[model samples]
Target chain A: MLVEIYLIAVVVALACSLPGVFLVLRGSTMLSDAITHTVLLGIVLAFFVVNDLNSPFLIVGATLVGVLTVWLIETLQHTKLLSNDSAIGIVFPLFFSIAIILITRYAGNVHLDADSVLMGELAFAPFRRMTLFGMDFGPKVLWSMLIILIINVLFITFFYKELKITTFDPGLAAALGFSPVFLHYALMTLVSLTAVGAYDSVGSILVVGFMVGPALTGYLLTHRLKRMILITLITAVFNSLVGVKAAFVLDTSIAGMIAVVTGITCLLAFLFSPSKGSIQAIRNRWKQRKNLKKQAASSHIKS
Target chain B: MEQLLALFSDYTFQIVALGTGFLGLLSGVVGTYATLRKESLLGDALSHAALPGIALAFLLIGKKDLVYLLGGALISGLIATALIQWISKKSTVKFDNALSVVLSSFFGLGLVLLTHIQGLENANQAGLEKFIYGQASSMLLSDVQLLLAVGAGILVLVLLLWKELKVFAFDPVFTQTLGFQTRILQFILSAMIILTVIFGLESVGVILMSALLIGPAVAARQWSDRLGVVLILAGLFGMVSGVAGTFISSIGRQIPTGPTIVLVLSLIVMISLIFSPKRGLIIRWVNQRRKKKAYIKQIEEKQERSEKYAR
Candidate 1:
């Protein structure tokens, strides 16, 4: 049972971190934050129409809302009235606020609450097992998260070059006949789909943590895109494992413990990484200064 | 009119509305500095980060006291801000990356602490979860008074350092060149923003507080380019949203105060975006069309003169 929970956590974290690398590189991590929140509104609206929480329509609705969020933010940004960040700040709250209001008002008797949306119950995930024709398929979350992970991997593999070029230099990508806008929306859709898939177990806030934390920790350790992606996956898996163990020991929220571990890992990398750590930079500067002094003394003696 | 009078007469309604209104006014005034500094989202992160502080304070003190909880929130929020600044500065991570990571991780830690508290055999823990979405109707007279006093103090600080803040907001480089302590000014402004978030936690909660901070300032910016005017307009917009949201929510069954306030504030932002006299999309569109018509008229007259000359 615990293994299933860990599996779900690890898979969800990996799935989120894939698009997160591009988001971190493209400097739009906040867009993921905004998308995560707005998808709740989509879920709620879809629930109103479908009257079912587990229906596939919820994911469809969330993805559509996620795309709509990006479109709205971009349109508002293009007006030049506000900065892109401000545009994001303005748009997401509107969607999220409406969602909350809907849940509190008409959906009072439903299996939805703002608390569960923010702090998901990961412990109960294993109990909700998947079964087909008297055969046990393990936890529902595991299968869903696995499907998301496979989709994410397939997407990254097929469009690796296009994603890389567009993320690094959209102008070059456009000049080379690749539509940056299309790729961007495609990435955002993937992010949203992954977010909704992961939403049931880790909730929205943890989803943001899973997406940004591992990618950033990887970024601190490597500069190469492939290396960064590999490191991100490793960090996600490592954090999820440690986080699960720690949460079990402490009897606390698994997602929160994972997030805390993510923070610590990023901090450790920031302080101790060989190439880009601050401590490493300080040591290099000191060594350079010492070498310069030695060279100056040698020159004086020769003179 | 009678219902409005009755609402004012009701003690609970009066306290909640007054407290939220003052909160809105205060955050609006202080949040301008944040938005101008491009740190609007920092408020979002700070509010979420403050949650663990409240839980920790409750654990240590074994009670749910407002002052100490807010103090704890302030301390943790400051720590989060410091971490964000340090991470972005020292690492290869950008500001947004640092922000999202710190924001979510801090919030996640808060959740862990909250759940731990929930498991403990204590009845006092029941009220702490209200900070997540907030229960404005539960506010007391003392809460309103604390809000008023702290809000006034912040307002006084804003006034005392108005010139420095304005300069810092518009151009930190210029502010430093003018012999001002840029770091101290930044600390002061950051403190002010954090204070606003803490006070607002009870009224608007963590999730919607960013909207309160960002909405009013963005809407105010649309109306005027002047900083002072924008501040005043933002305060007005925020106050109106708070009071109006409170009233509407009070009348409706199961309508929450925080989301209602945010929805109202977003309405103000949308209206300002589309309909403001200056910097509005509608107005800009109209002006462009008129200019195009005039230019076309001039071209036609020039064509007629050239044709007469050719004849």
Candidate 2:
């Protein structure tokens, strides 16, 4: 059961980190943060329609709302009325606030509490088994997160070129006859889907940690896109596994511990990565300055 | 009508309403500066990053005193702000990435601290979690006094530094060229933003507090181009939402004050976005259509004249 929990955490971290690479590359990490919050509105409204918290339709509803959030922000940005960040800042809270109001007022007696939406109930994942034909298929969270991970992997694998082009230079992508706008929405849909899938496990805000942290850790270590993705995947698995053990020892929130671990790994990479680490940069600068001083002294003595 | 009167007469309602209203006003006035400087999302980051501070404060003090918790939150918020600034300055990482990373990691640490406290089995820790979603309905008169005192101080500071802040927000390079200390001004503004976020966190919670800071300022910007007008309008809009949300939530069963206030503020934002005369979408659309029609009309008249001259 404990191993199953770790697997679920790993799956969630992987699922979040894949799209996170794109978000980091595109500089839209906060959009993931916004979508995580707004997806609650989608889930709540879907709950009202389906009247079932565990309904598969909740994911559909959430994906739609997430797309809508992106659309709204883009539209607002096009209007020149508000900047992208301001648009995001305004839209997400409106959605999240409404969702919270719904849960507190109408769905107060139900299981959709706001705390679970933020903190997530990862420890309880093992108890909710997915039984098929009376045969238990381990934890339900593991299966859902596995499927989301597969989808993220497929999306990135298939659109690697288009995504790469659009992220780095959308104008070039457009010149190559690829619709940057379409790809943008497609990536956002995938992000929303991943957020909803991981929503049950890592909650909302921590999803940002899982998504941005590992992707960034990878980014700090490498310049190549493929290598970055490879590094990010490794970082995700490493962080989640270590986080599970730490949580078991400390007996605290698994998601929180995972996020802490993610942050630590990213910090390590930032401080120590060979190419981009601050320490390496500082060392290089100092060595260069020393070389310059030596050259200047030699030139002066020869003169 | 009687229910409304009864609500007003109720002491808890009065305190919560007053506290939230002042908080709204404070966040609004400060938030305009944030939005102008394109730091609107910084409030969101700061609020989330404040969690660990609250948790650590509880662990050290071993109590649920609001003052200590907020103080802890302030210190942590400042630390988070400093870290974000440092990372952005010291690395090639984008500012947004740095903000999100710091925000979430700090929040994660906060959660860990909270769980640690919970594991300690302390008696006074029961209500510490309320800061997560906020329990404005449970606010005491003293909380309001504290909010008002600090809010007034910040407001006075803003007024005193109004000219310098205005120039700094619009153009920091220009502000520096004019012999003003832009770094000090930047620090002061960020501190004010952090203070506003901490005060609102008690009522608006971490998630929705950004809305309180951004919503009113965004809405008010739609109506006016002048900085002073935008600031005053945002403050008014925030106060209205605060009071109105408190009222609406009180009348409803199980309705939370934080989200309700946020919803009210969102409504104001939507209205301003669509209907404000100067920069509103609806107005812009209408003016564009009128211009298109006039252009077509002029072309048609010119064509008719050409045909008559040819004949």
> B103, model 2: CA deviation in Å?
1.3
Model 1 segments more than 4 A misplaced = A291-303, B298-311
Clash-forming residue pairs, model 1: none
Q: For model 1, how does the per-residue alpha-carbon lDDT over B1-311 read when each residue is reduced to its tens digit?
A: 89878877998888888988998898889888888999899998999999999999999999999999999999999999999998887766799999999999898899899989999999888889888787888898998899899899999988999899999999999999999999999888888998899988888888888999999999999999999999999999999999999999998888989999999999999999999997899999999999999999999999999999999
Worst 10 residues of 1 chain A by lDDT: A112-121
Give Cα-based local distance difference scores for all models.
Answer: 0.91, 0.90
| Per-residue lDDT of candidate 1, residues A1-303 (tens digit) | 888888888888899999999999998999999999999999999999999988889889988999999999999999989877888988998899999999988899989877777778788888888899999999988888899899999999999999999999999999999999999999999999998888879989789999998998888898899999999999999999999999999999999999999989988988998999989999999999999999999999999
Q: Write the per-residue lDDT of candidate 2 for residues A137-184, one digit (tens) a residue.
A: 899889988898898899888999999999999999999999999999
User: Candidate 2 lDDT, tens digit per residue, B209-264?
Assistant: 88898898999999998998999999999999999999899898888899899889
Shift of residue B218 alpha carbon in model 2, Å: 1.0
List the candidate 2 regions with Cα displacement exceeding 4 Å.
A291-303, B301-311
Q: What's the residue-level lDDT of B50 in candidate 2?
A: 90
**Residue B239 lDDT, candidate 1, scale 0-100:** 95
